[model samples]
Target: MNTDIAATLPGATKTHRDESFPVASRLIAPAHRAVVLAFYRYVRAADDIADAPGLAPEEKLRRLHAFEAALDAADPAVPLARALAEADRRHGCGAAQARLMLDAFRQDAVKPRYAGFAELIDYCTRSADPAGRFLLALHREDEAAQGPADALCTALQILNHLQDLVKDRERIGRVYVPEPWMALAGGEEAFFAPGNGPARRRVLDAVLDRVDTLLDTAEALPRSLRSRRLAAESVATIATGRLLARRLRREDPVTGRVDLAKADFARAFARAAPALAHLGFTSDAAVCRRIVAGSGSSFRLGMASLKGERRRAIHAVYAFCRLIDDVADAAAPAPERRAAIEDWRREIDRLAGAPLTPVGRELQAATRAFGLDPAEFHLLLDGMAADAAERVRIADAAGLDLYCRQVAGAVGALSIRIFGATQAHAFALSLGRTLQLVNILRDVDEDAAIERVYVPLDRLLEAGIPDGPATCMVQDPRFAAVCRALADEAEAGFAEADRLLAGLDRRALKPAILMMEGYRIVLGHMMRRGFERRGPRPRPNRRDRLRLVTLALRGQP
Candidate 1:
């Protein structure tokens, strides 16, 4: 509706250019595309301004304030202002969610370090949870839906921050690891010391413990979403979050980058599907109570808000994902860790033969009910092993593709199974691949700084760029060429995602569309900037994001 705002913002072009909405293709129902696009554009735009480079500290503060003021005024001239207004007009989008985005940007500008886990949760409340809440509102879900949505969102935000700790600290000079834990490890100065040493390990262990606590909390939110469709989403998110958290806990924060393998994602999805489906039919209070009791502390606040069979199933799925992920990410040496993962994989395998533990029993029941395949579970373990092996440097587009398949695409395969998307598996896998590529592109700078390259080696060589993550982005002609090539590949992946969306169920379409569009927007930014030069990463401006949202609502697909 307001292209003027998109045109006016200095970063709007870059934001759109940098983002890669891999899932926002023709596969989506033309009806829902605009709304999905609009939401993503709004989020992207806000993020861009918050992360923009070359602005003085004062100027950054001023810009953030101006953005916040726009939210308050409902001015169409402001970037996200129109989207917020539209969400209100059409979907009853709350001012609180918009305000939360602004607050997160404010935090980005000011808060560089976290004091403790509580403070970290406060950040997630502002930054990550609001997006989930906004999406729930878009779906016209009631307070009951909103509560669980918030929990899942908050959990995801916490897990993401934990996973990116090393990269966040090294590239951004900001640390999300709690201050108290850092103190216990040997103080801030010691924690950041060059070289992987005992102090770093100690700090990481403390951080892992904190992560486990947060994950326990996150597992509690899915029970509130009574709708089978929404519960599936929540379960997938929880399973994914817990898996990542477990990796963060088990990995050597000094050397490895924590990421969910595609196979693992599929397994989580398969394991969570039946419970999610069951939620559609039952509203048993006892079931909800059992789930709440098992979820540990993360669900403590959320427990009182929900009651049903769906809640219990969600809790069981979350707990299982968290435990399995931890097993994969355990701090043991690679061989031992792989062995453990294999053992877990065997246990999952034997579920078809016989049940072992409560979690396993639950998973077996759910898998049977959902008609999930055992092979998907094995792929998850394989992906976890790949991650544990620290084998994810971006060497070329081919390598990147393989990595994406291992880390994210596999999840798509599993998700379709859980969603009963038998016919749409190919499309789902394509969308998943595109999303994974977008992630790699978005985190290029940060990933490089942490010595984990998801970029392909062949691409780098073709571009005549150095293979090392830190040096690849330097300003060289070949470096620029390589970046362009990679970006093009990402674009191609996005195209596939678009095709995939057209085949998915309508109820399951919007969220995937929004996520895809968000990533595509990021990839667009990367493409525009020649990807090689990275003083700061590019993202969408608020106005452009709003425009995208409007387009999504219009069903442009």
Candidate 2:
């Protein structure tokens, strides 16, 4: 530890958390603040070493590697290194991420010239990308978000680079200004030289154009998430990036310095309150209400009978469920798909009043309203994750049962709890299982097309149908038999759930009954139309829906 005290002092001294520069910001839960800060301390210390002009290149290299070594250590002797290790162990962070920042710092000590925009972006990959990646890990965001977060972080890095161009050239003899752009604008000498004011400004303007595009690319990132705290902070960061880009446009970057004023953030923060409300789970239950209405016809119809807190709670659950299904069904690459599902799991792990995604934040509010248990919420995630796989195999009835519990049964139980029914646990589970099984039967063709085989492998084999999505399977007579069998199971489940619901209060239970009946009617039509063949998918016709409303009027008739 005492190998070179004076040389490493700056990095060590700068190790304390910076109040002005939030590692994760106030929007992050206090419980997780330490994980965020631990990363910051390690990265900040390494960053200080790279920025240290007093330290020689070899010395910087020596100390930085020492920091890197601390990654795999159980307990690093260096304070910053210890924090890095602690964050890794505590939050399940990998040493690999800490190594990424160290690599960037190493580049900073030696490599100063960026030949092109792409090369500069590659630098940003290692330099700025790591921070967003680790932050997402802290927020428990999925891999789907990492791309956009990386884009945002890279833009910010470029902005900082542009803002410090003059100082870097004058003191360090470094040039991060892309080489090709420098030539296109004026020339290296004219752009970097202090006297050639007009030419240098032109080069800076060209650089600003590139930064502006990056900022534009990152615009939708905040909307894609549901966390209020992260939303508020991300919007603020986006606001600052936009503000800085404007400054680069207005001020002569070659002569004047660009600094973010507190007023700029104040103005943006005020604007963000409304933007965040739309993007975050607001107090008004708007996130739940809006997503439920827009998501699916079936959900809207089922939830129509619910009102007041009960309705809001169900909508919140519906909204949350809808997001998980969408993540599983998204046509992204496999890694991204898995990340999307894991993000849900992580958010649920640390769920509180404020979460990163707006839907999650709303669910938190809904949970508070109905006293919803997170354990059941977790079951919903497990179900979604199962669907996210390319080809989910159900070996037998047992597998299908677990899948149903994961996807719908858990949600059903949560809904019953929300609806003020304490004793109808079996009913809720049965209903969810019933609905999910019906959905599987109804979507057999559609699910097969998506390479999904929800019907157990044994059942498919028994039915003499192939196990994958193919034309032969579609035309096979056995496939129809499989559909019939599944439909029968769903029908049995429907009768059971209906019988169980009768034991609960019939007053507060109207909405629940209507929803169950809605499914029952759909199941009836599917069976009538011969579900095994290329029959039309069942939709509740106007008359059918009206009948449901009429039944509701008769007090669970």
Candidate 3:
């Protein structure tokens, strides 16, 4: 098998162009990209047969069954199967495990809605769990490590289904709200009706409880991936998952869409980096598995480097942040995402102390120790949950201010507890708010291109411009004036950010300062470019980042 031929296989190219996988992300390792791309291509081909438009149901089923038959054969001739065989001969790709994906893809033809929890888990076993197992096999993770990876993958799949209920229903006419739950909520007839409040709430709450359990099981993956780099990735994945879960719980999924502001994502990643790095190097899969499965003992060991209770507290906060983020970004359709976010908002209102998980318990302890405001945490969660469902266009500077406060300012308040700010929280929050404003301005064109208009409708109306892209507004003198005004407001936020930095504890201020200064420089560049355009995105370059780092060392504000 020629490795290059196998790498750029025609089938792989078609699959890369498919929508089912994030095949071309910068996040994937270059070494693994080709194989993963091939695997995705195979899966996409199978999925397409089962889902292609205008195909009769019987025909779809027949094709899927035939595909499964090919997988069971000793010497399959199908493009994907042939490619897999070639990869197995050279790269040692796991033939048996790859076949498992084919088996799972076959389920789309016959099984749509699950009967119950056990049946759902069974589906996950084939569809979701196998992908993680295959990835582990590729990485040579042993049985011990495989266990937690399987659990996390299954959990993620379940969460994805729950999030995508609306879109799934619209696309396939299949509802994943289990039969039992639907029955309890007055059967499918009432459940499917729009604005079926009682039925929607009951079904959502039940699903959320189950998802919470799955997340608990999945949370062990980071501990299982004990190597520092792997642990960081695991933490990032788990944190993102947890964040989505939190959004689902707080928001009414029937109506809201959840999202994590870029700034919030940055802050959360920075906060989790220390604990993730502490996991160190380890090759024993059994030990890694034990760490993930055991809970408190493993968590304590993972955080042993921290002095006193702060270690546990920070861990809990990081975990909570991860959970909430995941909920915000669950793979659900926009409507379901919105509903989940609304539910999440309610959950935050009811939150008293962190729950019993190691990270949660730690966070609870920290809140008590630091006298943190519950409202601030609640507000942050509210903001995230709200973003999941709502997509309002910003009309003017006032609208932009509101957007920044909800997305960025809320995060700044939470960071204060972790980093300790005393009188600086307000200033830090202003900086955060400003950074968010800058983001909105920089991404104005990109956002509108995605059918997301962040420019306020009022400003558009006032400028005698039609409500649409910033480009249209730029052509109108009045609308361009509104754009400039919004930019000036962002500049004001930057000034406030500088003041916030002045009040920070220097030792604890490096990350926040670096991030703020980076945003400030970008804003300066934007101002110089004449805020008249909204199509191209403005971002800082590596050289600019390096310059910012140097400036940080000089203690220059």
Which candidate number maximizes lDDT? 2
TM-score of 1: 0.45
Query: In model 2, where is the ten-residue run with the lowest total lDDT?
Result: 13-22
Rank by lDDT, highest first: 2, 1, 3
Candidate ranking (TM-score, best to worst):
2, 3, 1
User: Model 1, stretches more than 4 Å misplaced?
Assistant: 1-33, 71-80, 144-148, 194-198, 271-276, 279-557
Q: What TM-score quantifies how close candidate 2 is to the native fold? A: 0.54
Residues 11-113 of candidate 1: C-alpha lDDT, one tens digit per residue: 5534432321122223233554466566666666666666555445565566666655665666777746666666566766646686777788777766788
Which regions in candidate 3 have their CA more than 4 angstroms from the true location? Answer: 1-331, 339-369, 395-399, 468-480, 499-508, 534-536, 554-557
Tell me model 1's lDDT, rounded to 2 decimals.
0.58
Q: Which ten-residue region of model 1 has the weakest summed lDDT? A: 16-25
| Model 1 CA RMSD to the hidden true structure, in angstroms | 22.8
TM-score for every candidate vs. truth?
A: 0.45, 0.54, 0.48
* lDDT (CA) per prediction: 0.58, 0.72, 0.58
The reply for model 2, stretches above 4 Å from the true place, is 1-284, 352-354, 466-471, 552-557
